[model samples]
Target chain A: MPKKSSSTKNLRSALRIDPEDGVVDLADYSPRKITTGPDSRKASLAALEDLGAELVDLQTRLYADGVAGEQRSVLLVLQGMDTSGKSGVIDHVVGLVGPEGTHIRAFKKPTEEERAHDFLWRIKRELPGPGMIGVFDRSHYEDVLVTVVHDQIDDAERLRRYRTINEFEAGLVAAGTTVIKCFLNISYDEQRERLLARLDDETKNWKFNVDDITERRMWPEYQKAYAEALAATSTEVAPWYAIPSDRKWYRNWAVGVLLRDTLRDLDPRYPKTDLDIPQLKRRLAPPN
Target chain B: MPKKSSSTKNLRSALRIDPEDGVVDLADYSPRKITTGPDSRKASLAALEDLGAELVDLQTRLYADGVAGEQRSVLLVLQGMDTSGKSGVIDHVVGLVGPEGTHIRAFKKPTEEERAHDFLWRIKRELPGPGMIGVFDRSHYEDVLVTVVHDQIDDAERLRRYRTINEFEAGLVAAGTTVIKCFLNISYDEQRERLLARLDDETKNWKFNVDDITERRMWPEYQKAYAEALAATSTEVAPWYAIPSDRKWYRNWAVGVLLRDTLRDLDPRYPKTDLDIPQLKRRLAPPN
Candidate 1:
């Protein structure tokens, strides 16, 4: 096992929710905490840029190592409320990696075909191959989060889904996937500000949805639902980190730190070649 | 019908194949031809940058128009030989358009489930929604090209596919989709150079496939197959443009120009809202 870095240890202690005892209240987490030492936004952003560059190298190695027979992958699951910076995190943080090894799937409302199968069927189809970094903009967690909030599934069904999710994630981990799940925890006040900004800016008007306001009305119920789901689903194999996301710079930085640390821990190495290098070199040399 | 611009007219007249005649010989077209006037590669790339900016605006309007009720879209079908730069076109040209309005589907070899359905069934599932710019990295054209080259389908099946493709494109056209098909034409020598470069570069080694070399040996067969397929499927509603793609700058610019002109022809407008402006203004005003 690799020795844990001070930064990774700090982040895990600060951000990771230990649900062994019970589910924690949303009121316990602040939506604007900047774990990085920088007090100013500019300093935090600068730090994120550094982390982004380091992440690119790590991801490239991870991809190359996977291609070389390591057969390992990473899945980053992002879940949050509307305008809570899920897309923003993808664009600013995850976008740092090259497309060659990065696969992103943004799940919309299920189609007739998707709904026809078990909920996890579509999710399984899009899993990243060996040496890939797969990102789910919203994931299987949606089944529990949305279904429970809307009362589409009764308590019995909801409990079953939590067990199913745990088993599914455990399978992924066994199959050599390191899973990282994050909840972009944004305050209601921050979300209102974002929605208003979208409505106010003509360029951003395309992103504004009237339905988001309707969801905002059910904030308390959704919060309770998320708390229960995260508590039940968070496991040793796939832990959940509630990211304070009111500050865009801090959120991006924190996620970047998490990924950089995770990749460092993985420490994927280049594959050892079995080729006869001397013979190949002689064969490739130009004829005299 | 929208009036065609001088640029669009020039491109259509110069690059479009007259499929009504017969299958055209690949030797008849020069792969190095730069349709855009500038002799310098830098000037060509500079021109592409300008076109890229305009494309962003046009795509935004196209997406907004789709959302507003126009129910129109554009599908860009790119087919080419290996190392002919299909991915390059997507990155440099298509990448200019925002993800919000752009949908890209890179079709790989068919899965068991996909093969069970008619070839067109999978294509239909991935069609861009109204107001989106959908790109098929390798599309249904693959069915005719690869299958015919390998004799995977009998002559009778091949004939049926041609008819199916033409009819399918016609249906898409009737449904308000403006189809632009581009066959990136590259010479055999250019591909050899690209393959050699991939072999030499450590980073690009991942892209160098032994099977690509095997495929290279069957180039003549593949060329003949593409010629026949293009001739059979090229229609007035969906014409095929054989782009001279040896010059990367010229290829990128030509594609950008094609899209810019196509979007200009479309002239997608922002949807007119049904809201009463005066009443909404009064309602939104600060309470006195």
Candidate 2:
């Protein structure tokens, strides 16, 4: 642990930031000026990898205790725009967690059955158990976003849904679930470039949709919806951390850090035991 | 891909198994005859890791396309008892998938809210998007196992729920969701030893639950529950594979093989595109 702390200290020094620095304000901090050259990219990737490994190790330790006690669980919710890299965050961060301890749910369009229930109906089922971590990619907030932006639901209904979501998340937090909400913010130009790249590349062509481009034209509406969503739902229990995601690498790094911070705050440790070596030798030791 | 195949062939050769040989009957294969020498352990771990990496790469390719298309997804369900090495399987296999294309959901005991809904209700929301892979650890099958064995519901309800689960799985299959269910079968003696070790070791004490031992005592009931679950749910659309899990290393290897087979069958490829370089350049090139 000392070695880890020292290494982090060195890396923080290299970043020329205080080791105790909280959120770096992206509003004023120009990522372009941050200069993600080869060295920086390598460092960022390494940091992500480090954070990922730590998160997994911590979660595993927590699960071992969790399954033993069968008493506690954590739920992490990731809310981001299309290609805000929600999938990437899942791919990178939870990727490190062992399957025994970690579970992820990626919510999509509502089915007829789902439509019959409240928007939160499907999500509540996927919550993590005691000693488990559950991740939601494009979670219940979609009801607030897509429904609002596309005018699929009336404004009154949408507002009611927002309150419902807030209440739902509040319930989860009250139940001892640590809810971490992240909003990935990618610049419109960057999104267009990525979408076009997908369109142009043979291997990426499947990702391009004319409908997505049409949706891109509604960026202002989507932005307004996002701002409102964040404003309405970012509570003390489940605050929204808006990640600057123009650079894919940075998105990965930021999410990893946030996860690490959250899990460390969890302080999961191996459950204590009183070993009886003599008794165990009689039970587990092979017959001579 | 050819290199991977040939290497897998070499691996098969080293294991001295016929290429056409299907999964062996574990009951007929004596455990005493199997030596757990260092060489064998290394070989098994290496093979599992190789297979896991291949599956990750394959899933990643599928996911990239899925993200582009937004229409296809893969649902992987892994069911096992404690210490059945589900984590080992996921750790090795998904370790290689890029951070953008995979999701995992681990089902725990129902919350107060979850218990209020139908068993499968929460699961429906967590389905993977097209091109993404969703892994469920101890999924809706629990509705049958826990409820049936505990007599929490009547036999008629259990049967109905079983049918409901099968139908739900089949629906997922029809909806472009490939369902691969894996059951890890470890012997009772091994489970007891593992649990005792968890209890004995201070580092692992948190994982030792008096309830796990209680559950272990209900082994016969659970076994019957599993057998019934397997019989009822294993279908052409989504069949269940029982992996011999007395050995953690072998369990990981077997699940990795199954995942590899499933992903390979999915055959995710990069979306095709006609990228006119001139057009791309005209779109992105700076205005002189």
Candidate 3:
């Protein structure tokens, strides 16, 4: 077993939005704020080296505990604008752990079959089994975010969906899934810069979605939709954390810290042996 | 882009079982053989650090290509007795690439639902999509190995399944999935030592199955089953590689090299864009 790396840092509370805080005002949150953990890019990267090791240990324990029949699991839901580095978190942060234990699903445009069902139908199919870390690149929240920004859903339906989401998450929490949702918040300027960078880099051309510019035109509408959706759905059991993500290093480290802390709190032990060790040891001897 | 680490070493050919060679004699193969790549444990570890960077690059390209509609993927099928370190390869080998691009499934015994269908029915369900790396810990081969040894299947049935597996693999290859099968072969003495070590360690007790002792008692039967299976199914399109796995470091590094080389061979490229760059850039500007 690796030596555990514990810290007093409470990234969870530092970044969490309280239910009473009500609708989040996008302007109040800085895209460059370092609320906890490392304050500089270099330090965050350096700290990640140690953090990665600690995460691997915790993740392994979680997987081990699950293999021994523990039913609990962790789910991380990452929601962000195109350039907010959602995929970056999966690569640099979750990349630190063993792939076998991490179940990742990047929700794309709804397929014909998917569109036929309720929003949570597809999401429910992909939930991680016991002891796994489930990551949603974009999640059921997209049903609210994208649809609302485009005015596809009416107020009555949108409000009803929020209530449905809350009930759904509450069920998940009751069934032993610790859900961590993060809204990777970046400034409008950051999105423009990232999109431009993709345009300039020929290698990144495939990632440049033309619709991103079309969406940028509705920036204000998106902010309104996001703020309202986050506020309504953020509950005590599954609150939303607004991560300032202009700095890629900070965003990656912050998510890594959140995962590490959650796994640490769960404190999944290597399960006790059900087998008779002595008898098994004797049986294991080579034939004479 | 990091400079590619090209090597003359063909670990694939060095380790692959030739179909024309007929049945493999386990005694003729050394469990600690290092046919290619780093010969020393420390050197293999160091090489893995560099290999990991190469793999991450290749895996990223493969994923990007898939995103751009390229339809090619890799499947690695791993089979061995307990304590042969199948999970170790997952952690130390496949873990080098990003989790988003790798799909790992460790097949336990067939559930009631799995048994109701054809053997390949469940296996087919887990096939990796475009640009993903699929790994099966104990795969379709188990039907031949375990059932045959336990007298559940006759010789005629075992041979028929081999033909079915070959055709299934040929179909997968035809559909752009490269299949690599590895039989992690370890000596009886090595298995004994490893089992004893597991029994000694309290933390690893969860991994120590009492059934492993029962399996070990039927070691010769398993060897016969494995050798015959490898011989019958090893084909030009999908060959079985008998990996010498007594040394955990060698086994891990060997599998890593297999994945790295396979990805390097595919050489997936970041896709070209369909959007007009200048027009998009102009539209990306914020309102004055």
Provide per-model DockQ scores: 0.20, 0.34, 0.66
Q: After superposing candidate 3, which stretches have Cα over 4 Å from the reference?
A: A1-8, B1-8
- What level of docking quality does candidate 3 show? medium
Tell me, by DockQ, which candidate is best.
Answer: 3
Q: Flag the better candidate by lDDT, 1 or 2.
A: 1
Q: Please list the C-alpha lDDT of all candidates, in the order they appear.
A: 0.79, 0.66, 0.85
Candidate 2 stretches with Cα past 4 Å from truth are A1-39, A64-75, A151-167, A272-288, B1-26, B31-39, B61-82, B94-193, B211-246, B270-288
Clashing pairs in 1: none
Model 1: per-residue lDDT, tens digit, A183-278? 999988788778767666666666655566668778899999998998898788898887889988878878887887888889976555544434
Model 2 residue B93 distance off true place after TM-score fit, in angstroms: 2.8
Who is ahead in DockQ, 1 or 2? 2
TM-score, per-candidate, Cα-based:
0.86, 0.72, 0.93
Model 2 error, position B116 (Å)? 9.4
Top TM-score hit: 3
